[model samples]
Target: MGFTAMGLAQNSISGVIKNENNEVLSNVEVLVSDAAIQTKSNENGLFELKNLPIGKITLIFKKENFEIKSEEIAIGKQEQKIMVVVLEEEAHHIDEILVSSIFNKTQNENVVKIDHINLKNIQNEGAINLSDAIATNPGVNVVSTGVSIGKPVIRGLSGNRVLTYTQGIRLENQQFGEEHGLGLNANGQESVEIIKGPASLLYGSDAMGGVLFFNPEKYAANNQTEFSVNQVVNSNTQGSNSSVTLKTSEDKFKFLVQNNYTTHADYQTPNGETVVNTRFIEKDFKVGTSYATSRYVADFRYNYNDLNLGLPEEDIEDARFRTPLYPSQKIENHLLSFNQKVFFKNSKLEATAGYVFNNRKELEAADEVALFMKLKTFNYNVRYYLPDFGKFETIIGFQGMNQENRNFGEERLIPNAKISDIGFFGTSQYKMEKSLLQFGVRYDFRIVNIHEFGEIGTEGSFQKLDKNFESINASVGFKTEITEKITSRINIATGFRAPNLSELSSNGVHEGSNRYEIGNPNLKNEQNFQVDLNVDYNAEHFDFFANGFYNSINNYIFIAPNGNTIDDNFVYDYLQNNAALFGGETGIHLHLHEIDWLHMTSSYEMVIGKLDNKMNLPLIPANQWKNNFRANFNVSKNIKNSFVFLQANYTFNQNNVSEFETKTGNYLLLSSGIGTDIELKKSNFNVYLTATNLLNKEYIAHLSRLKADGIYNMGRNIVLGVNFKL
Candidate 1:
């Protein structure tokens, strides 16, 4: 019988659920008694079972496609209420070990999903941004000003089609500005989640490509204050960076503050020649605060950053590219957000509000008045959900956003643009014995108002315009477990994206890409329909997953070569074009051995996309794959509290190339690292050294946005880093 019949005292069992690798797992089904009382975990891997009788109970922890676990738990009348649980990957048979990489995964009969890249992977790479770490994934590539400014490009989609976020808040960078970087840093972050294929059911608009969510560490435990620091030095460019973080939490309050600074010189090629070397300086600061009571919780965060990075510039008179564009890539950004939650009985309500401000300045490649731009955005959202409504749960939400874009340049005085959108979203989920069904829908109403400023030379017309857009997108998905160890999932989703400023008013040289891009005023929003499927299998010692997806776009806005035009100058216009898309990705993870004190993990991913029945799509990579091997060893006699890890990754060459551009040849890059941990009096110290492009391969990636003559990825770089935790 359920709890009410038992004359039990009020108490709780609270704790975080983790895997052997110390990574959190969400939605793990925990059954507390033989009567089948169950509870699920939150995003942070936190869970609570309240109002339980103070007596002996049998606890059962089971998840779809995972081995069932049964344990005897005694609930003493005056015992502690919190206990941490760690689950181990089970093996299918003798001599066949299950693989459980640090990657997070969920499985059903038809679908297996993996979304998180943990700190273990992040520590093995020496990079400036989240994109650098993400690029290690098989189906993922980057389109950056150079290696240092990478942004994820899934399949054939990049730019406005992809969406990025920090924690649960939307990223505020001027993403529509193709020259801008994704800007999120990996320092002090716990992990990053990549939602591939069509995820429009949760995120709106740009889900056509995919979404990257960076999650920071949660609050510390037991009101204890903890500090962490990372210092890194790179050999390729003689660069260095450092990050510091402080976190603490009490029963009622929690917070984290982090700061990072980085400086790098121009990078080199395998031959050690400075290739269009540029210097960059960056600083980032973030603070997050949270408070919670029995029925109420609140969270707030503030992020700030300042960056000055150089770009390539071309000289009109000499037909030669210039070094270190006078303006450089200077950007200042600030973001603030607040979230509140109220709980009653079996339902909860959440409200979120945020503001983002960004400012950027860069010198024009040909014209004078330095190009400067500013963006201000304000957004709010409200959602409510109720659990225990029979076998189904329902969620409803509303969101609103307002943004203003301002541009200042010498050639043409483009007026500021105001953009606004309002949306409603809802999702419902039902669970059967071995299957789950989910349906979600979103409706958006968007408007844009533009004003013209100054005179438009005989080159083009200058006018004011107003536009409105209304659209509805929906998604349906199913996940089921065929047996206790195999699961599958399938989904169909639709998405829409509104035009941004860069696509509607730009008319100058884009220093970042070394291209003179002109905007089209008559462009239309793009829409997408997509379907995805996946499979996951978990054995005693091996875990693996495979996923496939196809996406098609209506009114796809692609840049096309439209001859040349003569104003006071002659320039080629890249106009918009319609197109269709299809692609998929698959990966598998394996765990080698534990008894021998050895652990091995490996994975590979493949992605493909074609447009208009053609094999070529701009800036999309074909056939990307990565193989990672890591070994952990402990040193007990020589050093106290010491361990070492050796890791390596190999990225295969891409075969996909654009028809409009020269065919890109494939290249192989290799990276490796080693780290050791030591315990000191009151703190812990960890040090590591990483070498990238270990073989000194000198080739360009097909998806790189580097200019044909300028901007080269760094070659043969070494990084030494140390971390102190207390």
Candidate 2:
């Protein structure tokens, strides 16, 4: 839930490293993965760790031209130990240890398949925002309104269907609207793990679509201090992003702080047209601290974000406005999280409580706040890890949230409401020789209370009401290592989501959507069941994977035009129906054995959604094929870890569309980049240059709201970045 390093070492451990032939292996790397502790073997092939916590920890050893090795060990409260370690002279990939997904189990050992991407991989692609960064992954897409505002779409489900968690808490912004953006920044971010199917079995409701869990940067090494600075410049929008971070950790305490600032002008299209009122500015700040002993651990984290985003609904005659123009959105968010753990002799308890406040405003003119809303959410989770039994691991948890939404200003879209949710779940895993079985069951109860607003019987009016929803869900999964080089997995899960305020009681024209919408008060819950299958083949020089899923949903809610107009706005009605969606992703990675430094990757992804009546679902991404070829090598003694890459992504034409949507033509996007790491003694620096939309193809994306206005996405942008560390 918090940072991974939970150290409580009270004793000392020493070890000696050697090769198979019993020769001392100097310069070997030894690490405690979860504790964020590492040391290099001296010339004598000896390493020592002082004051380790009294628990089971994974010790990993690595060296050049050698296979990675790991051992699980338990430390006593008061003990001194010495050990010997031996390595084999071969090279192989090591599975990543997951922290939040399923405790400390590696990816291969888990029954549920997940997708992960390092934040650096996203940055190296020159992504300007988190939404764009994650969209590069398979089975993921984004619905964009402009260059500055985009929402993540997973497996053709978006809006209130999917759930997002940051800092181990649910991120609640005004995301019920499709025009809203993910209120997140990458100031102190690390990597992200994605559960591609129904995750309600773990994270409760609204995760029927899936879950996006973001992990923050790990704490600094014990007894060490670190500082870094990063800056990037963009050519298309004349944008600039800068950030600074400082972190320090001691034997029993840790602290970290970071800040980020970003600004941009209007983005230019491939046709050399500047989209008016597309500028934005952002400021972000973060702080974190932790304390731990052998049996107790506590962590606290805080973040603040402020943003001003322009909305390009019309042209602005004035060209001198430096900040956002009229019809813009200003958002401010604050997050505070506290985590604690209590360890017994054979079991442990982990609990995290978080508070989030979001302030959102839409301005229509000079100093005019047409629509303003404030949302406050308090969420808590507690999980108890039972002592590991032979071939069995079990966990029981309880999760709940209390959310309040209030409105101000002239526009009233939804009524003021208070929503509460509580859920209890238990899950366990059974390990076998070559196969693993995992299952879980969850019970959820939710209540929504709406307060009346505006005049009775008029638009933007609501009556006082209260409603309750409950559900019981479960999941079963199995993973089998069919052969030495092959693995297969299958999972079946059920998920459900109660109707949101916007889908239940809204009766007005939403901001920026150019439509009059009406909600159905009697809408039922959306329940879904999905089956997922995955097969992977890993060999010496190649890796291949194929994934497929079929999902069936009941009481799916959709909005469509009813051939009528209210106040010159198209009248749309929210409707419900049974629906189905099926999709798959396949990819292959090849490392050139002869070339040694060259690698190639290719992948394709597709999804199709349909109602019971055979009508296509709206906003589904088109079929895609992506390819990348890269080379890595040491440039010189001073410049090391240098690389170059060429990439191409092709989006196939989308003739399949809903009645209210338009078809889009096919297009190809080309991009390339170069970068390197520089090490001058104790100081380090990194610099890179990347270009996107190399061919400047001016095509409208199928999922972009700007397509209705005949606007093209950003094109031919160059980004230059630099980093310095001390």
Candidate 3:
């Protein structure tokens, strides 16, 4: 792929590392971010990466107990001489490279502000699942059917408007249904990155709300084999989660396998009454492999998920672990993806493909299946990153997907349909001394073909239909430093989403909602324009950030009653109108420079949505205020990285609501945990104990779908977990 790869020349780079005392450092990890090339320093503090492309590239050096170093270097036609670098002891956790960013820039350097968090940090905060972990971030919430089933709501938007990506591919699992969950497990993932605003210019259609990207765990170090296991126990629900991962890596090849199992009984409230039929079980298995050279890289991953979930109605029972009763759901999901990258002397090209299979079944009785369907999707993406033009960088890409849905049960929620999507986009970034500018344009076309269902003119029948939708979207952003420690960023973006089948072809009795639903085949696409602003101040021991956004949407889709009834069910119609939402988040972090062992953090976030007629939108999250205080201490040289924290979360009363919604009062909850690590010969062991809803608060959340039934969220639950590796 490169000149050196073609045998026309040989290009190489070497480096040496040392400590402040001028002593040699061994086992230091040296990496080239863009090229996917890495090597470890030998006993002599020397590392070399050969067959590199001839151009400017970034190098990263990392090791435990030392500050990370990022260096920019240029490689010429010939072999490079050794470069020397010095490392200092780490004072605190600092910035790390963002994997989901198109340019691989850190948070401080990117024009668009992104939120990133590690899974370990989330676990320590008393999060028992993926949904709970994501909701800990600012400006993000979840719409929960129960403790086991939660859907992410980003900036007041849920359903198909938000996109989920894992292993560099989209995740599709009938997410348009209100009762559908995220269909993801947190077993093998390393961290998560969230784009809080519109991302349609980078992703295709369904990204009007935002993007959730999960980064998988890394393989073992070169020429090493590792095995890791984790076990978690939850008190209130009597749940247990267990996982094991094994990995082996050679110089250029790596392989990994992971297995996870989770099971929970009904969750209990403060009064000790369990929410009946809230139990669930999940079995997840994942495999991954990769091969890389200086000029090329290839990776593959596959995951299979099986879930058995029970649906709660007007019932209460004692907590117990058992198989789900009637009115339960069984979901099976499969995902496989492969990607490869080629690096030339001055440019790079990447191609990726993925396939997903989803089978969902709703059982009404032991022998009766009320609904069953299968959805298959195929996705592809190709991109070319042009060499730098002075200080400008550019990328052109094509993305598309083909999907189909089929029903196998007697009842069909929507007609069998085929969906296709195609989009082309180009984005660019320009760098200046103290500022960066980014802008992009994207064009997308989507087609939905619905087949006939049942009888044509009957009450329980649907008609055949075909629709096409297309839109052009664009985004622009700028980041600049106003002072040595103060920075500001502004981004404006336009996004769009094609109507899903449920909105375009529904003509049936929806039992879950107790309404006779009707669909409008003439519905248009939902489009929106949003503007975001962020400011940050970083001092020696204190840092503050404020983020705000305003979003306006045209042709917003919703359902409403029309003063009619079918078999005691209210008749509702699908409708559209203009709507707007605005919100912001502000937070501060104080490191307590005088006392290196202590640090504090706090934040406030809120969002409000209203239609053009001034009617409030449904399912909006109430205002929230969160605070945490943490302290770290050292045990012994062999047993380090110990920490403890206490946190308080308060939700303000939500009086503003739609006509059909009820108001929710304010509530506060406490959480805390402590963990430490012990090192052994080629092994490590860490343990932690955490508690959520520490005070056993009995209050319902404003955004919970179960709020109408007066069901409270999970109460005081304690968790114990351990991680061991060898």
Candidate 4:
């Protein structure tokens, strides 16, 4: 009779468990004891613990290589509510390793290399944008015309030598146009990854400088329903930024709807001078589904962006009349894509396809001038994984793009182009106990077509240059563990970049650069030789990682000295010229839990490059450094809330001015912020106070476009924001 009573008690205490996405997990192993309960997350990441005392209890969650998660909860009621848990990805390469891509140095097998900047650390340090955050990394530099636009220059290469992907697909921007910024919205991004050197084995052309990758809020595991609003009011500029997202899940269905808007009036320098008046808007939405019928998972996404460009800081003086002369441009983009995965006995297969449409318009306020351009792109990629013989992986993909540019003039200006490209890529990973080795290679083929424009003046015939360019690209890499806490990786690769429509036909002033940019019809394709070496270290609670890179270019098509002239006032003709480049980047991090309620992280980056003769690269960033300090403390116990933290950052400006161009003197910028998390019955409230440029430093950034005008960076700024989760 007593044994029967014990059995009834064991069946009395059980509750449901769900993953962070709210999906019910199945097949999870749950073990309950007198004081603690242990369980394994199910296929859907759900679990349940039954038959427990109504008092304080401890829970532990674990999986193969995932970080062990533990928490204490009070069981005061008979029927406990369902609990939702989040499992963060952990760095597997090294315990003490501090990789740049993952905020806390989590590792992934698909990634052979990574370059990352933690937003939390940089947010407190007065850093803005993905480029500025990465500036502290060793071999990285921002080849910027001004603050409005910044491009990553790794090992002295960018543009065609590098590749940039938004989400996971190629981003088609007039990046080769010189005036174009990264094109994607940066303010709301979670983190950015830069794969220095060659990534051609995975990403195709324009990846010579490496790859700039980003994931929006939806990419974060714990990003469910969040709402945030921020305002920055200062002596130099007035701005506001806000974003809201709604996410929900039921069994195997999930969706995320998000919207973000930012607007900043004209910003002035500390010198009390107006630099530039700019503003923009962006909105994104996505939905995903997972079906367990046939051991398959599928996801589909669609996003849209509408951006309006205003006059550049250098062109604001003539904003009205220079509308046509200046680079005031507008761009609208729409994208649709889908990815599916099929899990087999010991392997998996993945397939992905996407389509993108982009439209560009340029207008001048002076005489009713307008220009229109459109680009359409399509892409497809597939990968298959197999076990047994060292676990092999292979990938194949193809991309096709068509573009058209039309200019409104007295007669007619039309430039149309088409591009077709295909590539085959393969990689193999060998695993032996604690040892791992990986190698990959890719081949690319591309062709271009150009149609003639109306006959033009003696300055230059509007004739088109039609030709087919072909090249072979390849890459191989290997990674190994020197010790339990140390890992090393090395890679050597080849890359290529074919001239895009803008590079081959554009013959006007680039609105963003506020300068005349001429295109070369006879420009040949550019090629690159790239190499990388990296080391990762991990400890119980701390991590550190470093990356080194070297890149050499042949037929490096840069803005060459045309020796000719255009219009009347501007001189110095710019066409495509061959150049060489090289450089590297490194970073570190330290985390502590001994203090219980306090934590801190610190990091830095440096980059340098040169042209053909190893001379100083014209726009290469000067040596730079950044440091951050932060602390968190608990404030309440009833609602499980905490007085989050206070953080401060100091940045050392570059002293190594470019010899090719005048360099700005070194300067210092500081910032501080405080945040709090409040727990509610069913939601969470977060609030923060941030002060930027605390010292009110009156200094100009070397990368600022207004440097020539003696315009300083923005003066002290204060921002107040709030976030709500439900």
Best-fitting candidate, measured by lDDT? 3
Candidate 3 RMSD to the real structure = 3.0
As a whole number from 0 to 100, the lDDT of residue 153 in candidate 2 is 84
- If ranked by TM-score, best first, what sequence of candidates would result? 3, 2, 1, 4
- TM-score, cand. 1 vs. native: 0.83
| Candidate 1 residue-wise lDDT at 35 | 23
lDDT of 4 by residue, 483-593 (tens): 887878887778887776656665555445544555677877777787777787876566777776677767765553344456642423334444555444455555565
Q: How displaced is residue 183 in candidate 3, in Å?
A: 0.7
**TM-score winner between candidates 2 and 4:** 2
Name the weakest run of 10 consecutive residues (lDDT summed) in model 1. 95-104
TM-scores for all candidates: the values are 0.83, 0.95, 0.95, 0.78
Per-residue error for 442 in candidate 1, Å, reads 1.3
- lDDT, candidate 4, equals 0.54
**Number of clashes in model 1?**
23
Better of 2 and 3 by lDDT: 3
lDDT of each: 0.65, 0.85, 0.86, 0.54
Regions of candidate 4 where Cα sits further than 4 Å from its true position: 1-111, 116-156, 186-190, 219-236, 279-293, 313-327, 391-414, 456-461, 569-580, 591-604, 638-660
In terms of lDDT, the poorest run of 10 residues in model 2 is 1-10
